[model samples]
Target: MAAVTDAAGNPWFSWDYVQSNASALLAALIQHVELTAASVLIAAVLAIPLGILAYRVSWLTGPILALSSVLYTIPSLGLFAVLAPFLGLYASTVVIGLVLYALLVIVRNTLTGLNQVPVEIRDAARGMGYGKLGLLTRIELPLSLPSIMTGLRIATVSTVAMVTVGSVVGGYGGFGELILEGFRNNFYKAQIMTATIATVLLALVFDLVLALLGRLATPWSRRRAS
Candidate 1:
């Protein structure tokens, strides 16, 4: 295919570039979604319990949030480098790092949501002979649905962005790889723009899906708003 360049003599986005790399782009898109989903799921599993514990034991809250905050501060590439020896260049390294980054948002929001439950509600549940588990599952979790959903949405969007960083760790193909390859191949603008746009679209799509799920989960909130 003939190269497409702008009047400024610089390569620009073209359908030809997209058509040629359709297979690779599709593979990368799938990889990005899989990585983001896996990371968030793992994070939720680990975070929810910790969040509960942090809520029950006030002293644990500070430390738990602190640890996650520190983990979040680690540079993405640096974290990958640290994990490479133990996990090799596999996707596990990326997933683990993403999970760590997501923990702060998930755990904090979980705690916030649970704490937001009215004291009267808790007392009522207790008066009705609800055990601790019942109180948590039926009373707290349902009320906290909105907050937890917010956390999930935030984590999902952030994870989608971070997964691109994983492309730096060879063998972990994602949209980031396309961006990097584009830069490496003399600023192949078409590849770069396509991958970047695809990544943004993915994040927006996930955010919207989560928002819809949140609405479904907490219909009472919508009812109140209306």
Candidate 2:
């Protein structure tokens, strides 16, 4: 049974609920990570390239950035609904929604990091026989890694939370299901516990990973400290 009787006639943590459904819980969490990772990774790949191109071309900057920023203002559910027909009732819609959500931050930060590079340093790279690509790869890319990483970290956290909306469209995975199930069943504690645990744990995990990456990418900042 999903619920059981206690000795005193009060139900406790339903061992059957967890044990019988352990696989479902694991599957849901795994699907959550899969959806989140695919969206974020795709956004990173596409945004970095487009952002770099945007930085290089002054004419493209205003329009491209404005368009991506507009994507951020749209509600997540609305975006999913609009794309659902085309992508169908699956994780593709979720991935597309999340990717759109991530683009503005990623592109803006990439541009910011590239623009923040010192003019004199760039000139020196050119003087040292570096071409545009060489200067970008060796000088601009390394220097900008820290800021880009910051953008990615923010995107990851945001996407992790935002992905809960995916289940609303029938993706059938993630902590969203836990919250939904709890709501439908009037199990407030279940909803609160799963939501809280998923949020806190995901945020902490990503934040620490990004912190380490930031420190590694910008070791010169450490020298300034010591």
Best by TM-score: 1
Alpha-carbon local distance difference test for all models:
0.91, 0.82
Collision count of model 2: 0
Q: Tell me how candidate 1 scores on lDDT.
A: 0.91
Query: Using Cα atoms with residue i matched to residue i, what is each candidate's TM-score against the true structure?
Result: 0.95, 0.87
RMSD to native for every prediction? 1.9, 4.1
Stretches of candidate 2 off by over 4 Å are: 1-22
In model 1, the runs with Cα more than 4 Å from the true position are 1-8
Span of ten consecutive residues with least summed lDDT in model 2: 9-18
lDDT of 2 by residue, 167-208 (tens): 777854487777677667755453445554765687678778
Q: Report the alpha-carbon TM-score of model 1 versus the true structure.
A: 0.95
Superposed on all Cα atoms, model 2 deviates from the true structure by an RMSD in Å of 4.1
Clashes of each: 0, 0
